[model samples]
Target chain A: MAPTILILALGCAYNEELPEKDILGTVIVPAAAATRLQADGTTATDPRFIGPIFLGAYSGIDTVSFGYPHPSMGPIVTADTPGDAFPYGGTTVGRYDFACYESLACKVVTGRFSDYNDMLEYFGTVLGSPIQDDNGADVANGSTFQQACYDYFYATSDQEMAFLGDLDFALNADGDFEAAFVMPHTVFVEGMTIWGWMDAPEIVPANPTESGGFSSCDVSTGREFDQYDENFREGRVYFDALNTPSQYIYAGDWVASGAEEAVVNSPDDKPVVRLDFGFGVGEAE
Target chain B: MRTHGNLALGALLALSGLASGCTNVRDGFRPVLTDAPFVYDIGELRVIGAEELAGVDPSTVPDAVHYGQLGAGENAGLYGGATFQFRATGSSVCVVVDPEAMFWNKEISTQSNTVQYKFEDIFEDDGDLDLSAGLAAYYTGSPGSEIGDFSAVYDDPAGVEHELAFNECIQTGYFGDPAHAGRATVEYCDIDTSLHSGVMYTAVLETFALPIDDSILNFGALAFDGRCADLPWYDSNGALLAGASECVIPNEVEYADANGIPEEKAWFPELERAYCSGVGKVNTFCKDNPGAGCQSEEEL
Candidate 1:
């Protein structure tokens, strides 16, 4: 009887060692950007405004362009439209008409195409002609048409692939603004890419001449791609399967390194990834 | 037989241990309250004007328009702003009113309005003068043609006069038109002698408006007890004046202590009113007294 009881106790203690299937990490922002005054007179340190930071894991799926309706459909495919126009058929496109469809497609296509001139040439060919936008202008196959399609798309595909999460920075015991996130273990599998942004004001000046104090990227005047690139230039850092030497990957240099080297293990064994804005050094204790 | 029994006992013990461990893991996931990054101690004053459908065409106004607390959600109230006049004696702190102090909502075009004020913003010294005690007079009036002379005067024990300005008024372009003009005044005060170490003082909020007799006439006042003190005026015989009941002062200390919760706290007066009206969350005050007016929560 004594031996049976001892065995039961040992089994319970050993079961506690089983690993949790989640990828744990911390996001660090420069003190200057976190403390900068927002338009509402409150800084990112305030919880109300701290939720702009987004993190998403991609399965390397081509969900943006190839997954939706064919480009020949002119950026808008409604439920009533013929199913043959879309590659995957009508049920997948939902009830999206021309007006609502253009905004989403433009944002996704803009994120996928990095170069401004290259996007102009590519969209100019694929987007059909005589597609009148909301302002009653012929936007097909023109630079003005391509500029209209620009906005923030977090992942490579629209399905959110493997995981999508948002981090909210709050004043910790040490009074520093910090956010933490946990991704699924499947995100570490091969052919998966992780990307995110702090959704904060531009840390570095966009114009070469202007200096001092951060400024928000103006999207209304057809500067969506510039704003997207500015967000990446502010800071980029990620943890892959390979445990590569963690460092900042600025705008033009960022590439989605597939998680071929990721090691599936407990959160305790993984190192924390820091996303730092150029203003100051951020550390995770 | 003995060997077989020992092997069976070991297996059973291991299974029991593993089951217990799984329970412990699930228990760890239970949520517990954490410290909030910021805390706000808020006090809300809801002023609902009575139905005023005299001069204007009643057919043009919607049923919901007459109610002071408009909109859908819990934060909805009279959509205008008020000027809180704070007068203190026994202290030389100059009370400066920020021009942008009024919280106005132009959506509702009625005389009803709700004013939400934070205790820390008014009393706490953020490199400014710290206010102890006196009188907090809140003056709110309906839409008038031009800005009126809305002012208050406070006399301390030493006979030195301190004039506090309450010059905030809602102005409309149609002042000359009798159909759109009306007179509705909601005045209340809060006096807490125990909270601050200062001399007792009396203050008055006088509002002057254009004479437009045909507009809707409605006057409604609601004051929370313990937090509200009546503005008392006595004759030589030391008798309370006739209109003393019309004014109620807010006790700043008790107001803060009632609504200030260190971990995750927010108080909505609309929710309290709904609770008092036997519709929403069960309030203790409303529960104890069946028909108690949904005064703002004295202790949240």
Candidate 2:
């Protein structure tokens, strides 16, 4: 089927078994609450934290919770550079490298932003696109879409944000932030159909380097036919286009309804989204 | 005089029944079962070469394929899940056995080569009840007999104006386009073995890129005016596309239908509202179901 639009959501919540990590260092837990103004004309109280990623009503794939196998990294990190500090450093330096390792935990979860909009803004940064509103305004400052996503994320988080040591939502809520990267449904369809025709014209943050070199990755391409067909017609090629598209950038899996019943899951608990595609092998008339 | 009148009335009734074949199974319902293996003739066949195959691992062949059936945005895809057991003949069109059909009815032929079918047959496996049924549950009469008689009208993007009509029954055209109107007819199966009789019926799916009349708008109005209050703008991909519209429609008059409105509600305001209100709300629920909006209830 002409890859009809699919919905993939990434939950950005922290867990005990799996803590948020990056090139800089493992996430530092939070210590205190950061107060903010509430809509009820009163100050809002939060036991500030940032561990899990808050996911909207979409599903996750091509990531850990989605059953993707992790790649192994040989003894590379000595007692030196902490994993959290690597993502922000230069790849050529003695920083974290994405070249040697095929799969790393850093790509799974990152620090949490105060609200979900911060998460989307982070996505804009990673995708190298500027956020824009319907009226064509630069949405970086703040917009209805941004605020609504934040409110919805807070509400769905059960009013409790995740935190590690000092690198928690309470402390790092300022500026733009990101959660764990998840495969977005939009990217999958577009990537499959248009061959990355939608990748926006922007520069993604460069990878940090270390003595081990950029974390190893396996990226190759080839073709094959589906022997399942009577004459081995042609094999299907599947790509993970989630959270990665070129044009008309946006983020989160939440639908507009905002109905309380629509909240299916949180970031810690990844969602499952199925693609309904069936084949009818029947007569030809 | 009374006896003579009764005899004449009986004769009239019998004559009418014969003319329409109301009782003959072969002639009345399964007329296509005759010598003609193929029911609908191929009017216009255009294949959209695969430009880009996104996300598909070049190794695994797809179970189905959807080429550009209509306009730039118009498309079609084949669907028959794990239940798909038939093999593709490897022709421009493929053939397979209908497991769902066989499950419901055992008397029908199961030999893959026994019958000739096409993409239209996939709809029979219980997809969308309203859209998939075509004229079977709605309009009456033989679609094939009237195929050439039906007019094809195309509507523009605004969807209110009718651009032109094609005299021939084109199998494919830009769906909802102002310049095209005609139904694509394909055959499907309800497997019948010794245990049951399948629901064998021919269905026709009509498409138009834009609305031919105001009837289309009244069917599923999104109230783009912004006052959708809790409602959000989900992209065609089901991701939150835009935030709640800051521009709420001042009145129902300001409401115009967007694309993808249900056809049953395309006319008659009361029917349209009753049908669409339920659908619009359900769409929201389906969106929450994780890709459920893009599929049928059974698929979910």
Candidate 3:
């Protein structure tokens, strides 16, 4: 006779091998911008108001609203705001030490645009599907407009169109300025947009189209987009582990084409996405 | 059988706990090491003669060393003038001499100096280890003692070529130690050259010394130049000796051929080993057993 017995062990183990949640990168600004320029040029020696750059990343099918005239979609991270909220219980802000930048502190404002809907409502645009207004008439979405926009722009179905966390800039060991963004690995698909706003105003501007001539997220009557060249810089890149090298891109190139689609489609881990800014000190032409 | 199984499980759990608790988890992780060395490019080498020393208060010129009672303007000499590069590693300092440069004098052809340059022993620890304690110990020990010697040939204003030997060179500069922030001046005494003329010609030259700023520590190029080996070797009794025959490590081609390692991979370590053996004091094992692998005796 043979004794028959079965044993089963059921216990939860801590997942030490969790996928990295942040895309890390370095940001190198001009020496002049790093030194004296304040957020508003009030205290700057150069009076350029180009100090304390604001950086953000958007997960949409299109790159249209990533820059200025869309201040309602506030910056998710800035030097002042730490522990700001983001998706999946993550902080909207990343790590930054003022000392690394040769400054005792930095002054910048965090935008209110934390997710996709806030961006769409502010821009009054949609992505794949058209939503009916109170009159049952179809509203203008990204697809119908035939304008340059990404598919993930206004879709709420999946995690595709989500605001990636904001990042704070700091100087690395190599003496280069850098910033890192923490977002779900799912947001790194093709058509991701990374944007930076140098010398961003402390107050986000009002959107004229909204009821009361102002959007809910508007903080004040903002400066005109044409007034400052620091208004917009956008790039389309799929940042994953394999493509995770510090990228040197110019801030003046408003529509910079980054990594190729084929490379972006390939499977890889989500590592730090290094972004170096080539914007030197001067007025925008 | 059940009791035995429980006992085994308990022992396993205990062992696991002990292993996890006792071992340093941080040691298991690899630390980020910087490759660039702390480069102190001499912006200007201000050489003041003994006569200039007369007008200035001795207290004001803390680095002023009296070499010889040489005449004023005639005594000031420049060897490897401005842009002279001083590359500091954790353990040794290499005064790079560009032979093609005008001040170095092409006629001398880069003669080797017999003085070995080293930081206080505390810097030799692993790059990942904190060096604050070592820096504290060094600054506290003898802040003004001569760390090494320097030698070069310079023609005086009279066009007479004379070998400039700084036997008592005191390194003074703000190493930017957290405790000490002001300048720690470095004064090199031309003792050897002064002895010949019976005139102590101390040319007090100012240098932007080591650990340029406070935030950086143990930062510099890992590879020691072959010219660094030109520092004179010393016997066990501190007697000045001639150049060691083993000082010449095999070139990349020779090293590759003998060990079957590719020259590309073998070159850097071989070059460093050659420097260590040439200097004698940095790595004694490399000096004693040149044929062995690049591991220092301390490492073995």
Report the C-alpha lDDT of model 1 over A121-174, residue by residue, as the tens digit. Answer: 322322212333445454545444434433233333323311112224555665
Measured against the true structure, the TM-scores of the candidates, in listed sequence, are 0.18, 0.18, 0.19
Q: Please report the candidate that would top lDDT against the real structure.
A: 1
For model 2, residues B228-293, the per-residue Cα lDDT tens digits are 122332322333322222111111211222232235322222321222332243333333333321
> On a 0 to 1 TM-score scale, where does candidate 3 land against the true structure?
0.19
Q: Could you list the chain B TM-scores for each candidate?
A: 0.17, 0.16, 0.17
Judged by whole-model lDDT over C-alpha atoms, candidate 1 comes out at 0.26
**Clash counts for all predictions:** 11, 122, 31
Off by over 4 Å in 1: A1-13, A16-19, A22-285, B1-300
Model 1 in CAPRI terms: which quality?
incorrect
Give the DockQ (C-alpha) for candidate 1: 0.00
Model 3: TM-score, first chain: 0.29
Question: For residues A140-240, could you state the per-residue lDDT of candidate 3 as single tens digits?
Answer: 44333212123213433323322222324555666544444443343343333333333321211232222111011122222222223323112211222
